[model samples]
Target: LWGEACATLETSVGPNNFNHWIKPLRLTGLESGIAHFVSPTRFISDWVNRHFAKDIIGVLSRPGQPVERLRFDVVPQAAPGRARSAASGSAASVRPVASAAAPATTRALRADLGAPLDPRYTFGNFVVGKPNELAHAAARRVAEGGPVGFNPLFLYGGVGLGKTHLMHAIAHDYQMRHPAAQVLYLSAEQFMYRFVQALRESTIMDFKGMFRNVNMLMVDDVQFIAGKDSTQEEFFHTFNALVDQGKQIVISADRAPAEIKGLEERIKSRLSCGLIVDLHPTTYELRLGILQSKTEGFRAQQPDLQIGTGVLEFLAHRITTNVRVLEGALQRLFAHASLLRREITLEVAQECLADILRTNDRKISIDDIQRKVAEHYNIRLADMVGPKRARNIARPRQIAMYLSKQLTSRSLPEIGRRFGGRDHTTIMHGIRKIEELLSEDKAIAEDVAMLKRLLEA
Candidate 1:
């Protein structure tokens, strides 16, 4: 009966989730509607009870057999003088109980070394655009599960930009390509917790072996270990061991390696030795594409719901922060329409998402633009609004004029009043000059792009 139920569960949850959460469970007995199962640790037990209990009960409760509730107990280990029994209740729930008879894969899962991969985040679901095309290509190259030309593929970007999504996609693709390979993916915080636990229990050697033996190791949000000395030391060793053994390592963070404050310089250099890819801020076309893709998925779920034209375009233009916020706005709109049994229209959307629209409305001022540009170019604030015709001051002043025109709704004459009472024609010339240089000079383009990101952020 347990074998049959296990087979059914492998189909319900994806293989990765099943292997991580369900495969380590051992059903010892079933009586009086209480199914007793022994788990390697409390974490897996609680996770199964919360997420997969109903599904398991549904499959196990047949006509002749009745199973309702699940009672979990940690696996027992032999002590100094007392022999352990399978039915004994032990308090060692946090640490894993290793079995000599268990297979290597099952033992690894029992160790709880990694987090579950999200089935929704995969290469097929990822949308490609100019800002993220290079990152996407690099992720695909690593997912081939072969020799990683770039050992540790470092992906960094601002929030909601696709770092976690691409990380999960790589893990999924690599697992699919090499089913027998040992792939461990976890957050840096989890790494810290495990290291601390091992230190407390004198199992540091086991922890090191488990981490160093993996075929692929991925650590997300690595900036979390920046200031900690011990965790950083262990992580550096783990990183070096994997790279030296020709194993693949993938890492993600919110910023570039060198830019992460409190991080060790040696660790940053190691991270920078590989191919560093940044998922740039999403473009307008990219946001629109994401909305369209999400709308299609929602349509599948709500086939009868009607969405009006121009709604997506309006959302794409208004919600310029990131992909998550854009998708969330769309989701709220769909839910509002479905709950009210109303067709989605532009006015209805505006009415439904008034709060989101209001929050996303960033009224950038010309003064703010001038201040930011001056600081970026390392010029004085007075020089920004004063008569400084030197190349350094003049170039930044022109860039400030360009940004003010692009970001704010001020007229050219009104902007002229803010910049040392210059004429409207002077503002126009400065704006035009910057525009021409944006296409002709790569440095100016990069500077403008970086400034735009800073302002938006």
Candidate 2:
């Protein structure tokens, strides 16, 4: 019965933790529904009682015949082969028991759960820009904490916008300052997988205890937990427990909580309780800053690689969407130049990144124009395509149709077909309307210029 309880606890608390805490105890006997066990030292016995007693009791309790109590004793023997490190306390004492008794399956699962963080994602390396300054400030304040000013600091943004970078920086910062504070950083998929594993093994209490005891919890890409009700419910409780106790909780996702489809309203409201910062697409200046910083870092590694002055400006202006891609382009350029014994000039870069550069330079399609215009005007894609008499979708859709005609080689009917199967006459009318706007409104001309630059780049 004691062995079975330990197995159940192992499944719930995770193999690494189970091996550390429960593997060393000797099951002396069971009597009157009471289980008695002995540890190697008094410290181990007390630590076990403090952290795992309630969970142990819950695991041992069954439908009808359940263990009512647990007893622990300290016994000194030629220390068990599995002994906790003296510094790690009694938990480390159980190391041998895990080595001998732990299954290969358990070891593999533990390895899967022990995902190492990327070392490059430190606070020192993160570049702060106007778009992410508020998020950065909020994260800094949370890291230097007394009372929890924000229950759950939610950061959302498009891909490659440094959402994950900021979250890692926060975790690394807190861990360095407060070494004793328990920090658990995992993706929402990881959380859900662990929860489901615990459920299958009937060790929900163990699962609850693992997350509940943490002083800081950071979950990345939380939108993955949107439709899974059981996982979401468990996460909600874990979130509240940590927040109610004034512990720091941080989450990152691609969109705002409310905008995340299928998320529970209560969970969304809880997420919105504190600061919710959105990381916008990097501006040209911000991209240049990132490129300059990245180039300097690269230069330290390869002092001989000569990246010309206007190279960064050209790259920054061209690769405008994400910082990651920009860095990748630079890396590719450096590698190609170094291997081929060539100068890292604009011509070499253009050759090395020909595929990416070509895709970047390709003229905007009619489809892309419609999508971008609809997004800018805050109108639905369907409404833009539909015969809606409302000016909201109609005007923007017309502007998109005009841009497509002026920008691409598509004929009138072809352009119309791309915009909800309208006739060539409709396309002509839309183009005329936008042309009139361009002549009268400076704002419209500026918008056209910006869109053209974005599309061309």
Candidate 3:
């Protein structure tokens, strides 16, 4: 009767779901007018009790074999060949694979999740700044594998904003703690490729079984599967099955799920159901810190080379677009200086990164900023530099001044001359006022940030 009921349950939830979530469950036999089941861990037991308890009860109750209800318990004796890891309090290791090639079985699974780990992208190496602190914190929580941590951890941002890096860090750290746990980390493109391969070879059951049974599943650049309907459908079901089983899932994308066009509404809601964190573009201070950390590593290798003062500062100030670009510029600077035996001066930086500087060069002028700010605030362009001390016009003028100071390399006196012949001190004061308001006022900060992105874009 028990075997009959399990077969019925497997049909209801599909093959992959049953293999991953239901198969691990052990029926300890019916007792006290109620059926008792055993699970490997507390998470699995609780999940089954909440989601499938009633259905399982209905299935087990037969004409002769009457059962009142169902109950689940965590008993280590029921699970075999599993041992807990010291790194993670609740995690246990799985069976070891003999080789890297576990194709359609556990062989390919070893190679797929094993070699992609980047030792450099750990929590220790990741620098936390205002732009990325929230994303970092959320990633850390998910990595901890706490029961209360939100599922379907969604991280999205523009290029080089550390979205992929954070995702990789989570995988690396989680694997370290849960050495026995199955952590499948890959890009969405790879996911689609493997899915198609399974379909072509009629081995989808193997694919589904392997993917569905993992402890942690991470898909990077999930936006790639947006317009691909078949892949999205498969991923949607896989996602629902995992979430229903109380497993931890992590995803990364270039943009928010809702902003991604051609994606299913159901998938969007599922992705958004959990915590969503966005990493803002790198700031000046963050850029400097990153350069500092990178240069410290370089200094150990080349002790004879000298880095001139203001070199890193200039690079940080000039290269404001992406961290990847910034790191590349630093590498180029060090290589150029070492090969030529020249100090890493601002001139050397300029010469080595001339192409990048030209590409990311800010083209917005004082007038351009004034026009944009006026247009954004619905104010008169003439009033931007006009002698109107009214709050409405004066605030817009100050925002323009602040933008000119930030988005351009113009000096205070030069920017002041553009604004009705005001002194440089007045320009500095206005810039300071906006800077203070940036911390105090959320609306102003968002407006300024949005305007900057538009102008910069």
Candidate 4:
């Protein structure tokens, strides 16, 4: 009964978890087909009892096995090592059998380690716009594998710009094509927590063994480990181990590795080994495409709900930060419409997302507009805040001042107070100049359009 239950669990739960949690367990004795075992620690015992005990019982009870109950004894860790052969009569012979299953068990363990990759995040579902075309190509290449051309593919972008989506897509592609390859995906925080826990428990080797053995490892938001010295050192070593073995490593962050403040130079350089793909902010067309894609997905779940082209355009234009927020807005609208048993309309969307949409629209201030515009143009931060009359910096600075007056409800004198205490007439002149340039210059017209998009974003 004990052997049958072990075999059933081995096949069902994969070998890695079985080895880590189950293999070490000593089947002490059997009574009335009810097997009792000794686990090394209380944590492991409790975990097994919680998640796998029922399955264990189900497996044991199959074929009319008379297993009625299973029990565990948490013995002294040192004592179990010494008494293994005495406690389990066939332990010496069991060593080779357990050794034979170790590799297969480890393979099974890797299969269950991380969150399942989302099917929707595959390359086919990724919509490429100018903003993300380069990043998309780099990801495709990484997914194709071999020679890694990019050893550590570092993908960075703002929230919801598909950093995680691309990472999942790459993992999905790799696993689908190479079933035997081991892949692990986790957030940096999870990595840090696991490392710290392993260190504290004197199981650092076990942590390293788990991570370093994988054929491919992906850590998202690597920036989260920037300032933690111990975690970074441990990760740095794990990264080197995998890289030296010619294993593939992928990392994602909100910014370029170099720009990740407080990260060690060695870690930064290691990250730079592979291609760094920065997904730029989404363009309007990209936003619209994302909306259409999300709408199609929503339609799949709610086939009866109808959405109009004009409503999609409105949503796309209004919620322009990134794909996540856009999808969130659509989800809110869908929930509201479905609950109310009404068709989705622009008015309904506005009502359903009124608080978010209104707050987003109202939150722009003159200072916000000026700082954002100046940053977008790459003018000196001082030039934006200081008095500058030269055409190069002055022109962008004035445009920023003009945008502040146009976008925010601040009065002219109030706006002046925010921008180097200039007179209200200076604000007026800047607005007039920008207005005149917008009418005559195509370049200025484009700049205005670009600025509007950035400010709104």
Against the reference, the lDDT scores of all candidates come to 0.81, 0.74, 0.78, 0.75
TM-score of 2: 0.61
Misplaced by over 4 Å in model 3 are: 1-104, 113-115, 362-368, 375-378, 385-402, 409-457
Candidate 3 C-alpha lDDT tens digits along 1-457: 4556667887887777565456666665566668765444434444466667767877877777777776654332323435332123211222212211233244343334322555467788788899899999999999998887988999999888888789878876775466446677789999999889889989788778777877788899999998999999999988998999988999989999999998999999999999999998887788899999888889889988789999999988788888998999999988988999989888777877888887776566788899999999999998987899998889989999999988777889999999989999999999999999999999999999888877764
By TM-score rank, best first, the candidates go 1, 3, 4, 2
lDDT of 4 at 66: 62
**What TM-score would candidate 1 get against the native?**
0.71
Q: Pick the candidate with the highest lDDT.
A: 1
lDDT of 1: 0.81
Prediction 3 global C-alpha lDDT: 0.78
For every model shown, what is its TM-score relative to the native structure?
A: 0.71, 0.61, 0.68, 0.66
Alpha-carbon error at 405 in model 1, in Å? 9.2
TM-score of predicted structure 4: 0.66
Q: For candidate 2, lDDT tens digit of each residue in 16-50? A: 76775676566665567776665543334545677
- The numbered model that scores best in TM-score is 1
Off by over 4 Å in 4: 1-100, 103-113, 370-441
